[model samples]
Target: MEDIPQKHEVINWKLEQLLVFLQYCNYKESMKGPLFYAKILLFGEYGIIKDSKGLAIPFNSYKGALKSVKTLTGEAKKSNSSLIGLYDYLAKLDTELVDFDLKSFKSDIDNGMYFDSSIPQGYGVGSSGALVASIYDKYAINKITVLENLTRDKLLKLKEIFSIMESYFHGKSSGLDPLNSYLSLPILINSKENIEATGIPSQKEGKGAVFLLDSEQIGETEPMVSIFMNKMKNEGFRKMLSEEFSIHTDACIEDFLQGNMKSLFGNVKKLSKVVLKNFKPMIPSAFHKVWENGIQTNDYYLKLCGSGGGGYILGFTEDFEKAKNSLKDYKLELVYRF
Candidate 1:
């Protein structure tokens, strides 16, 4: 007797059929896999790129899941069409190191199968990362299992693969976002290339609250990063980033890890000021006054929750009611109450 093919296997079979059609017409692969929603580093943006300690978590507000459908609707079809070009490129690349059931993968993609996710693009969340992780999980042969022991070496290997996978969206990727998605854990670290999962300080009563303030605009990360890179070329900017930004960022990370609430907020105050002075362009024009107001009044502190420009602005408030009152005109999404 033979075992029945599982639902996923059935879907894979359908995908293979579609791939044949696409290959016949010379269409390329597009999506790596379905991805879930990811939250941005409300405080760490350019700071993280410089190896300043950063923190990010999964945002459940929006999520995406992969499933093969007989038909796609609206944006789904359009997204799938765009992916064809990407898949074509991947097919031509040296994918010997990565594991992918390319034959079936191509078929599903060709048959109009697309990743159906609600995670918004260009908000600095790991939208592409989640998709990359999903693809690796579904198709990679001898893949790393989330259930198995994840040693540092395995984690590093996973990051390398994900970085390659996610490069399709961003011209370059650090692999941190997808790595976080793959592990679904709060990742803490000393540097980009050096990272690990660690425990976070729990919120305490009467402590500050970490929240998200929606900028109501979409932020394109590639451009923002480009700007930051150009700025890095300046000797003065580099000095300020290393001397001021890195100092504050490192202090905040250490204090948070040590569970020193007072020290964390103090360092966060400095971090907030530094971001306001250096990252003026990333903040939406409408929020400029508020950004300054928070720094001056200390009613609330604003940080780059993700890549800045738009989406959600990470806010830290000692008093939620006070912070709300201060920014009564804008919308606020509570993330964590510390």
Candidate 2:
């Protein structure tokens, strides 16, 4: 990390965020302004790419943003280093559509600017997506505004731009993560060709819930994705993916959107079984038993949150308290109540 800048002059917060920043603590706004939250692919983990339905929502608990710190330290310094690499990557992208203000980006880095993130890297959550969104917000020229009346074509264009920007991190990317984080809204993906901002049923005071079971280990997306790609080559696997996997997944999406909780739970149980049986490699060895136990006991059903080699496992239950008591030994974090 030689020649790394140690000092920086912070910029004023964006006009829209300044009022809130003044009332809240330093954590509320980035030096450059608003942060992007992490996102969870509530449904459609791998099936989405295979032309299945998907739903993604912002996970406000973890967030990241571009910052100009007086003294870089620890995670901030590491993030700055990564952004410098990103700068080099963007500088070489030979495209008119994805152009950025590279000169300002370089200057900002030289002035000790770094991405300060609370979002955990390699957690199937949108950590790098948040970084990419933050960079585009600060440096992209003629960037699309979230406030615009987003048309289908415009949304696809944004996803394309984000795919190019974020491909540097993942060898290949679909860009849904960044799109979800940038919009900070639930996105309903009918398929690769159809996507739009969507409204989901609001949370209710009920015992039923959807929660995340932390794996406590980082899972690299590249390798997990590669494994999936390789598996897709088998004809039997493709059959199962379509007949069993996508069938259940599509049903879950339909039921959830229609607010059919009774049917949603049933579809989720089947989806969980399909995932556990066929996507075995993605589930961590430690969680395999408990994942199955939840299904058998009807306490809860666990499914892959994202790529799933070792990230948070998404769980659904008709009764949260019952599910919590059933698996008392492990940690669980609630994401939604129904």
Candidate 3:
């Protein structure tokens, strides 16, 4: 729509190819969709669940694409089989309220069309959200033009659709993942209903680096969330979140946004401590000592890169060399500089 080829061209070419193939096969119309990389929440997790400000940025290391195939194989077959139930559920929804070319959609599924993505599932990287966004973009009828001036109401509607679509993966969805996928911009999630693209502060010249420490284990969001929900049932957990978690989380967001690096690290120290104290269950048993040592020794501060448990741990260090020396046992991926 903006005379740009990179984004629209790929989607359009794929759609045309599918349609031509359909015509040759005596099938229905063709639709196109864009794929996106997964995102990592640099900050805010359980804290955001309580309505504290959260920030997420696209992590291009992992990505997903939508393409129609005549057959599936191995894990792809199983994944497709699992998603059929979800597609069927969506088809049964009120037709007038939501539009989709169900026949072609189902046909693709029957023909073994599956999403081929590198984004690790349950790593808090928005893998399922990318799939959902791709489906809606390709098949939804009278789809909202993404190029149009997107209003608050439009954003809400999109979130609702994404929530339904992503439910197949997470059992429950905050809808932030798919929202970030569709927009391909950094999203600031203020509340479940209040989210928007926000500009991240520029990096500074310093010896420190903000990095992701891969736990080398896949983290299942559902199980991790289940664990948190159970923890929340305890009054002490709730009190801790209300008092320490929220305060530190809010301060961290404000400080980062204002480019107050010193203040941000200070708050991050508190956040790292709170996370270590309260989220012991979510942290890997093997990493417990390391997590505690980082906080107690002030060598580095570890926070949730996404949903914790496993995947990657967000880290802040005043001295990269010192932190690296201290965390030599674990693999670390640098994401930003300070």
Candidate 4:
């Protein structure tokens, strides 16, 4: 026989092994969880608010997922702390349209659960939208699964639910961001009430491209939106948005969807011009000349990727090489090619 305390020592070792196994399980589950990707609103930035067409596509460059941790630290700790606020907000939500498993959500949060994400916040790339998608995916009871046939009614229902949920982050939300991230598909907004899944032309080997120009700064949606609301009070600005802005935006969407690069460039240039002339406050002052130069020269056309106080500026060009050469000083990320 062994020492008198050998039995207790064996029990301790077994308990340690069990703890490791549980941790391994948690890690496995986290790894297997679905990743909600960031979304890019290619068209209909401010115009969508006033019932204009919009097109959004899932951008896999940045993504987020629900994860469990043995000990939350660093970004994970910060994320966990922030989730408490969301949990409180969700727990008190009075919506009869959907219900979340608050008990399980709270228990997970208490056990050091956090969203593992690389999507930058306040960048207009749907950072909070992805987080909201992750939570709804995991904790919502009778949640709408992506596998089902997403009829127009179902799509609207999901958007409604997401709008209410995401409103906690932004003062007001259209719900398009979270819906795009959640569905992982290109979404076309015909208007505020009519939205449907859409398919864009497959990427091709060509010179023309769509890219993101990094402003190297974060953008807050609330303030930018407030600025837009204040501008809407002016009759002239409202007419410009409805007549010039919306017209160009709708044409761009149509051209893009139809793969008519020739028409797309023409309309995108017009849209870029309108944005520069009117939405001056939305554009970062540093890039004011950069925006104008793109319009002056046919090298490229730049527009807002989101609300655009300071985030990524979307660019379109017939020849990316030329646009790259012209904007050589700035960091450019290619999003699409045609």
Tens-place lDDT digits, model 4, residues 1-338: 77576788989999999999999997787773689999999999988889999999999999998888899999999999989999999988898999999999999999988889989887788999999999889999999999999999999999999999999989799999999999999999998789999999999989999999999988999999999999999999999998999999999999999999999999999999999999999999999999999999999999998999988999999999999999999999999999
Give the better candidate number (2 or 4) by lDDT: 4
107 Cα displacement, candidate 4 (Å): 0.5
State in Å the error of residue 216, model 4.
0.5
Give each model's whole-structure lDDT: 0.76, 0.89, 0.79, 0.93
Candidate 3: tens digits of C-alpha lDDT, residues 145-204 = 679877777777787778777777778777778877888777777776777778887777
Error of 1 at 193 (Å): 3.7
Q: Which stretches of candidate 3 lie over 4 Å from their true place?
A: 1-33, 94-97, 204-206
- Model 4 poorest ten-residue lDDT run: 25-34
lDDT of 2: 0.89
C-alpha displacement of 305 in model 1, angstroms?
Answer: 2.2
Compose the digit string of candidate 2's lDDT tens values, residues 254-322. Answer: 898889999999999999899989999999999989988988999999999888888788999999999
Q: What tens digits encode model 1's per-residue C-alpha lDDT throughout 1-338?
A: 99989999999999999989989555223333444666555445677677777766767676666665567879778767755765665666675567567787688787776666677776667777777777777778889888998877787788778877777887777788887777778777567667777777666666478788888899987888888899999999999999999888888878777877777788888988888888888888898889889888888888886667888788888788899999999998787767
**What is the TM-score of candidate 1?**
0.84
For candidate 4, the clash count comes to 0
C-alpha lDDT (0 to 100) for residue 7 of candidate 4:
88
